[model samples]
Target: MESPIYLDNNATTPLAAEVVDAMAEAMRAGYANPASQHEAGRRARRVVEAARERIVELLGGQTGGRQPDRLIFTSGGTEANNLAMFGLARMAEDRYDGPHHLIASPVEHPSVARAADALACENWQVDHLEVDAQGVVELASLENLITDRTRLVTTMWGNNETGVLQPVAPLASLAASRGAMLHTDAVQAVGKIDVHFGNSQASSLAFTAHKFHGPLGIGGLLVRGDTQLAPQLFGGFQQAGLRPGTESVVLVAGLRTALELWHTERSARLQHLTSLRDRFEQQICAELPCAQVVAAGAERLPHTSNIAFRGVDRQALFLALDMAEVACSTGSACASGSSEPSGVLLAMGCSDEVVRGSLRFSFGAQTTPPEVAEAARRISKACKHLERQKHR
Candidate 1:
């Protein structure tokens, strides 16, 4: 059997061998419940603390001072995002008076945007910030949207679909000046870019392990020590009562190992992926003159490229690539099953035709030059076939 090329790392990555080994070892011997008082429990607690330390270090957070000890591990990126949005929104309600509002970019993952919508249903005002054609947040419009009633301003550090990196630092600073807490969903940004909780003004950030070559079903919300976010779950005092449940020592250990590896080799890995992405795009453009690279000049992540082919159905191209043994995506994996155009593209001022014709290809550590070249070849061929079929 031939090795299938994977260009969908933004959707999820294969678990690293180191991560699997660490997880297996943890499951074999670190089975004690961390909440118990026995020696085994102490051992489990130590492992959890050590994993937390590694994660904090990877995120470049200070170990001491008013640093964040409020790391709440959740099911995944979606849950972490929900916890950050709902938890902070509730806290704002309890602490402040009058109508509470939230400001978020329209290009945000549905986890954050949908949670804000749910909050809005409960009478909270939710204002969605629009992104420009380049997929960056319109910073000028942000100042006008932030008013006294705005409790939180939630935006993604990197868009999952277009891989467009937002001006999070400036947005965070703006939120802080307006007396509003800022939360950024950094799920796509954590391993691909440098994230510093100690230095960043964002009150909270969310990340998932799978995005970083770690095991799935594990992620966390990084809440600043001074942030007054309320717990969304009600139960035991696990994760300082912010996220309650029996901790998955195996998953946590795997995540820490993955994070450690990423921290050590981030620069080299980024350069490699960037080269692969650029090469892929160049080949695509050379082969298909009608293709348009979405947000071509924007500051996108090193691994991602979203391209639009004129008069070609993205779904057809997606399945064609899959059948050709090259795995890619139509847009965000979360919305892959849907036939509708990508909200991210639509929000970035892309025409309906562009939205319907877009495909997202993301690279990762396991991706190779040959794989990218082959994938681009397959895509060009598929586009030709699609065009011929349309003409028929």
Candidate 2:
């Protein structure tokens, strides 16, 4: 059987060899629980702390300055987001801020959006900022929605589906002016783009390791030193009690190695991905004349391309590509099994037909020109077949 051409990096990525080797070494030599006081445990603790330092350096955190001591490790992006929203929301509520409210974009990942909705069930006001046709949050609407009672503004740094970068700096500034904390879900942007948590206006930021060729089940939240958010968990004082558990030294080591690799090779990798993405889209447009590339004019991530076929069902196209040994996504992988159209597309004012027919193709380090060319050819052939069947 032939190997599948993978174009779904946004969903997850293959582990880098270096990361895998690091994890293997940790599992063999640093398996002790980081919380224990024995010498072996101290060795494990040292490993975890070193990994933290590497990640902090990658994110531009200072060694002695007012950097956040609140690096909380979690299972993944979902948990990080939940910790931020729930912890901050409860903090605001305890302060008696007129039923403290939270604001987020309508197109946020389900992790953030659902957490906000759950908070609303407890009488917290949750408002959604609308996005424009370019899939960007309208800054004016966000400003208009803010009130004296607003306690937090949570938005994503990079959209998982469309890979459209949000205007986080302006939003962070707006939140600061109102004395409301800002949180950005940077899970998709961490290793893929330059993320300077120290310089950013956001009070807290979240990121996962697997999105950048690291091991799964390891992620962290970056909190500013002066942030007032409280811990969500109670136990040993590990991770400042914000996330309490024996740390996974193996996964943390893997994440550190991945970040190191990214720092060393980011510029060259980005240029390569950009060239491949452009070639892939150009080939698709040349072959399928009726296809529309979504957000083509926007400053999208170098690896992602969302396109729509006028009359073809995206699910059918997805299966057809699968049959051709090519892997892609209809939209966010979290929404993969659902029949509903993407909320991101809807927020961009895309018509229902376009939403249902849209497909997302994301490239990564392992994606080669030959694979991209083959995937495009297969997609073009599959789409043509679907169109013919529709007319039959």
The prediction achieving the highest lDDT against the true structure is: 1
Task: Enumerate clash totals for all models, in the order shown.
Answer: 0, 0
With a 3 Å backbone cut-off (N, CA, C), the pairs that clash in candidate 1 are: none
How many clashes (backbone atoms < 3 Å, residues ≥3 apart in a chain or on different chains) does model 2 have? Answer: 0
**Local accuracy of candidate 2 as per-residue lDDT tens digits, 307-378:** 998788999998988998888998887878998889899989998778988999998888899999988888
Stretches of candidate 1 above 4 Å error?
Answer: 1-3, 66-69
| lDDT of every model, 2 decimals | 0.88, 0.87
What is candidate 2's CA lDDT for residue 336?
A: 89
Q: Which 10 residues in a row give candidate 1 its minimum summed lDDT? A: 61-70
Q: Which stretches of candidate 2 lie over 4 Å from their true place?
A: 66-69
For candidate 1, the clash count comes to 0
